[model samples]
Target: MQRILDRLLDIFPAADRSFILLRESHSQKLIPVGVKQRHGEQDPNEELALSQSIIKEVFTNKRSILSVDAMDDDRFSQQASIINLSIRSMMCSPLLVGDELLGLIQVETNESEQQFMPEDLQVLTGLSSQVAIAVKNAQLNEEIEAETARRTSLQRYFSPKFVDMLMSGDVTTALSGKTYLGTILFADIIGFTAMSEAMAPADVLAKLNRYLTIIQKLIYENDGNVDKVNGDGIMAFWGVPHSDKSDEANAVYTALQMQRHLWSFNLDLQAENQPPIHMGIGLNTGDFVAGNIGSEDKIEFTLIGDHVNLASRIEHLSGRNQVLISEATWQPIKHLVSAVQLPPFMVKGKSTPITIYSIRGMESHEQNGYIMALPCHILDENGRHLGRGILTDSTPLSNGLCLRLSTHMEIERETVLTLQVETVEYHQPLVCVVKVNSALKGAHGGGSSYTKVVLTLMQEHNEDMIEFLRPGSCVATNYTWNDLKRR
Candidate 1:
C-alpha cells in the first residue's frame, strides 16, 4: 500500500505527499494505514493536516474531487486545517469495491503554481478501483487462513458439532471468557502402574490407544468437549462453546457409556490373554470459567474453577469400575438414574466434607436393598477353602458388598474371595468372586469380635452379582452359618 502511495505521488507533477486511509473493521471510521511523503523529512505531524472536509466529501459522493487553490474554494475554505496548512491544490478519490466503500486515497500539493486538473482526478479514481479489489482479496485470504487455524486448534479440544458452532460466526459472546454452568468429568485407568509394568512399551501404547479411541469417540457422540489427555487420564466437559439443557445428562451418560463400552473392551483383552482393563470415572456439575487460557504463543480452550478440581478429587475417590458423581451432579438427574450414596468424606481443599454418590446405572426396575447375616462360603484365589464369613449387607447399586468375619482371621487386602451364596430364587447357589477392598474392625452384637470387610466384585462376576442381589430375586433368611449347618 505504501509503494502504491509512493507510485501515485510520482505520477502527479507537483504532488508533495500521498496517503491511504482504510476503514476500521469494527468501526466504520477512517484511519490512515499507508503514507508516502516527497521530502522524507516532512514534519510527521503536518501529514494528517490534510482537509477532512474534502476527504468526507469524496467518500460521501463515492467519486473523486480535484480542488484548485482550496483556500479560495468556498466548500473547503472554512476548514481550519486546510487554511492553516497553506494547501494550494488537492485530489481525493474514493476506494470502492462494487457498492462497499473500503476507504479513500488523497494526494495534495503545497506549491501554488501546481494545480490539480479534471484529468488528474480521473487517473486517481481508476487507480483506487484496482487498489480496492486487491485490498478486498487480501483481506479475504487473511480471514480464510485465520479461520483454518482456528478450526485446527479447536478440533483438539472440542467435538465436531461444537467446532462447527464456534466456526459458524454465531455465538460470538460465548467464545469469550465467561462463567458457565457446566459438567466436568475425569476418568483414568485403574492399576495403570501395574499394567504399564507388566506389558512391553509397544504393547502398552497399543492398548492405551485402543482405550482412548473408544473414549474419544464416546465423548464426541455425546457432544462433550475433551479438554486434555494425560497418559491414561482424560478430562472432558460439556456446556462450552454453547450450552444445552442436556449438558448434565449428556455428561453422565457419557461416563455411563464409557464404562459400558469398557466391558466389551475388557472382554476382548481377556480373549487375547491380556489383562482386563478397569477405569474410574467421576463427574461434577457447577459454574466454571471457560475460555482460551495461555500465553500468546500457545493457548488452550479449557475450564478452570474449584468444581473442576473437585471433579478430579471425586475421580480419585472412585473404586475400580465405578462411576462417582458429586451431589450437585446427582441432583438434576436423580430421578433418571439409580445411585448409592457414599459416606460424606473430606477432600483436600475444602473445610467441609463433600457428599458423593456411586452411580449404578439408568433407573432400575428393582429397588435397592440390604441383606443381613446370610451365610456364605469364602475361598481363596486357588480354590482352597478359607474360613466362612457372614454376608452383612448387599449393595447391588454400588461397586461392592460388606462381609462380616472373625477379627482374629486375617484376609489380605486385594485377596480374591470366591463366594458360594445360596439364594431361594434359583435352585443353584449364586456363585461369584470378589476382592477384599478394606477391612474395618468393629463390635457387632458382641465386644469387638468381628471385622467388617468391604469387597468389590471381580470384573467378570459383576453382572452375576447384580442379578443375584436384585430385590425379590434373592431371599435372605436370618440364619447364621452355624444355624444352617445345624438345621
Candidate 2:
C-alpha cells in the first residue's frame, strides 16, 4: 500500500500527499493503511485528514471527484472538514473490484500553486481498481492463515466441534484463565506395564493406539474434550470453551460407553490366545481453572485445580473393569444411573474422607418411575425360599435390581438371592438370581421401618436371565398381598 501511495505521488506531481484508507470489516470504519508525503512535509501521518464529504461522495456514487479549488466547488463547499482544514485542491477515487467497495485513495495539496486536473482523476480511477484487487487478496490470505493456526493449536486439546467454534471467533475469550464448573474424567489401562512387557514394541504401540482411539472417539461423541494424555491414561473434561447443561450426564455416558466398547474389543484378544486387557475410569464434578498454561514459547490448553486432582485420585482406586465417581458427580446423575455407594476413603491430598460410588449401569426410563408395591419372593442359590420383599426397580442391561423389605435381613454382602415376581397376565413367575451389592437398614424405631437392598447379577449368571431381567419387562403387576400370599 505504501508503494502504491508513492507511485501515485510520482504520477501526480501537483499532489503533495497521498494516502490509502481501507474500511475495517468488523468496525466498518475507514482506517489509514498507507501515507506518503512530498519531501519537506512538516505534518506526521496522524495529521493527514481527508474530507468526509468528498470520501462519502466518491463511495456513494461509485465514481471519482476532481476539484481545482474545493472552496469554490458546490458539492463540498458546505462541508465543515473542508472549511476547517483549509480550502484545497484535491482528488478522491473509490477503490472498487467488481462492484464491491474496498475503500478509497485520495491525493490533495493545500497550496494554491498546484491544482488537480480532470485527467488526473481518470488516471487515479484506473489505479484504484488494481489497488482494490491487491487489498482483497491480502485480506483473504490473512483469514486463511489465522484459521489454519487456530485449528492446529486447538485440535491438540479440544474436539472438532469446539475447534469450529473457536475458529469462528465465538468463545475465544475462554482461552484466558478463569474458573468454570466442569466434570473431569481419567481412564487408565489396568496392568499396562505388565502387558507391555509381555508384548513386542510394535505390538505394544499398536495396542495402545487402538485403546486410546476408542476412548477418544467415545469422548467426542458425548461432547467432551480430551485435555491431555497422562502416560497410559487419558485426562478429559467437559464445560471449557463453552458450557452445557448436560455436561455431567455426558461425562458419565462417555465413561460407561468406554467400558462397554473395551469389553467388546477384549473378546477379539481372547479369541487370538492373547491376554484380555482391562481398564478403570473415574469421574468428578466441581469448579476448575481452564486456560493455556506454560512458558512463553510452549503452552497447552488444560485444566488445573483440586477437583482435577481428585478425579485422578478416584481413578487410582478403581479396580479392573470398573467406573467410579466422586459424590459431586453422583448428585445430579443418581436418578439416571444405578451405582453402589462405597465406604468413605482417605485420599492423599485431602484432609477429609471423600465419598465415592461405583457406577453399575444406566437406569432405564421404565425403572425410573415411582416404586410399585408388589410382593416378591427371595430365595437362596439352591432355589429354597428364604423370605419375601417388595420389588422396586430394575436397571438397564439386566445387571441389577432394587428391593425394599419390612425388616432388615441378616443377608451378608455378596450373598446371592434368587428374586421372583409374578406377571399380571399369566400369573407365571419371572425369576432372576442376583448377588447382594448393598443392604441398608432404616430407623426401625420410627415410621420408616424398611431395609433397602441392591442386587447385581454376576456376569456368569446374567446370560441365562437377561431376557427375564431386561428393563422394559419389569412392569408393575396389579396383585394384592392376599393374591400373592395365596400362591
Candidate 3:
C-alpha cells in the first residue's frame, strides 16, 4: 500500500503530499496506513480528518473528485483544517473492490497555480483499482499469518495431536464441555518477588523465561498439557483432551524432574554469582469440566472446577523446593514414589481438612531413615536446654542431613542449636550443631501443639552426623540427655 502511494506521489510532482486512508473495522475511523509528503511540508497523514473533507466526499460518492482552491470549495470550505492549511487544490479517488468502498487515496497541493486537472483525476481513478486489489491481498495475507501464529502459540499449551483434533473439527462436539478425570499440577518460582526486585528488568525477564522454558519442557516430556502460565507460576494437567492410565504417575514424574532440573539450573546461577532459584509444586486428581471457555470470538480450551482450585490452593501451601500432592493423586502413585504423610490441614473454601503428602523421591531401595517418635534434646547457643522434641524424620542429601523435629518450643529460622540424638543406633552420644531451616507450627488431632522444624547440620559436622545416622546403624534406645552428659 505504501509503495502504491509513493508511486502515485512520484508521478504527480506538483502534489505536496499523498496518503492512503483505510477505515478501521472495529472503530469505523479512517486511519492513514500509507503516507508520503514533500520535505518541509506538514505530514498529510497526521493532519487528515475524514469528516467534511475531500477524501470523505470521494468515499461517500464512490467516485473521483478534483477540487481547485480546496479551501474556497463549497465541499471543504467549512473545514477548519482545510482552511488553516490553505489547501488550494486536491484530487482523490475511492479504492473500491466490486461495489464496496475499502478506503481512499488522495494527493493535495498547497499552491493554487499547481491545481489538479481532470486528466490527473482520470489517471488516479485508473490506479485506484489496482491499489485496491493490492491492499486487499495484503490484508488477507496478514490475517493468514496472524492465524498461523495463534495456532503455533496454542501448541505451547496443548499437545500437537489435540491441536490437530481441534483444527480438524474432530473434537467440536467435545468442546461444549464435558467432565474428565485428570491430574492437575501447579508450580511457581519461590521468592520470585524478591528475585525480581533485586535484578534489572531485562535480567529478570531473561531468568524467568529460562525457568519457564525448563518447566515447559518437562511437562511436555511427561505428556502433560500446560494449561496456563500465571505470572511466575504454571498450571498444567494430564488426561484431557486425551487420557491414559498413567496420568497420575506422569504428573508426579514431571514434578520430580522439574525439581531435579531446577537444582542443576541453580548450579549455573551459582557459577554466575547469582542467587539460586527454588520452586514449589502441588498436584491433585479429580473430575473437572474441560472445554472451550469464553466468548465465541475469543474462546479458549481450559479446565474449571473445584479440583482446579484445590490444586492451586495446595500449591500455595507448598514450601520452597517441596512437592505436595492431594490424597487422590497420591493413591494412584503411592507405590511409585516415597512421600511423607502430612497432617490433615484446613484450606480455604473447604469444609473439611484435606490430607496432603510431601514427595521425597521416586521409589528406591536407598532409604533415608523414616519418621518415628524418637526422643532428642535441644540445647540453645549458651548450652542451655530449650526443650525436648521427637526426631520425626531424617534424610541425607548432597547439602546435608535433614532432620524433622517435633518440638513444643518455637525454633527460630537460622538459629544454631546442639541436638543430642537419644536413639539406639550409636553407642556414643551423637551431638551435632544444626542450623534451623524452617519451622512450621500446627496442632495434632488431639489438640497438642507442635512445631515441625527442619534442620541442616553445620558444614563441619555433616560427615560425622551422616555416618552416625547412616541407614541401618545400631544405636542405644531411650537414652536421655543426662545419660549423654555422663557418657
Q: lDDT of each structure?
A: 0.76, 0.74, 0.73
TM-score of each: 0.53, 0.55, 0.47
Order the candidate numbers by lDDT, best to worst: 1, 2, 3
The C-alpha stretches of model 2 lying farther than 4 A from their native spots are 1-127, 130-134, 168-176, 241-243, 267-274, 363-487
Ranking 1 against 2 by TM-score, winner: 2
Pairs that collide in candidate 3 are: 424-475, 424-476, 425-474, 425-475, 426-475
State residue 397's C-alpha deviation in candidate 2, in Å.
Answer: 12
Candidate number achieving the greatest lDDT relative to the actual structure: 1
Give the deviation of candidate 2 from the true structure as CA RMSD.
15.5
Deviation in Å, model 2, residue 57 alpha carbon: 14
Where is the poorest 10-residue window by lDDT in model 3? 442-451
In the range 111-133, model 1's lDDT, one tens digit per residue, is 88999999888899899999999
- Report the C-alpha lDDT of model 3 over 79-136, residue by residue, as the tens digit: 8878876788888888898986778888888887888889988999999888888878
Candidate 2 lowest-lDDT run of ten: 440-449
For candidate 1, what is the TM-score? Answer: 0.53
What TM-score number comes out for model 3? 0.47
The deviation in Å at residue 450 for candidate 2 is 45
What are the per-residue Cα lDDT tens digits for candidate 2 across 1-487? 7789879989999888888889998988898888887866536634566688988899889888889999888988889999987758998888888787889999988788889988888899889888889999999999999888878877766788878876777654433677899999999998899998999989888878877888898898788999898767999999886777778878987887787566556645645567778788899999999887776677677889999999999998776656789989888877665555665678989999998776645543433532222346878878887666655555545455667654335777788887775332225655666788864433131123345677786667555345443322322334443453243
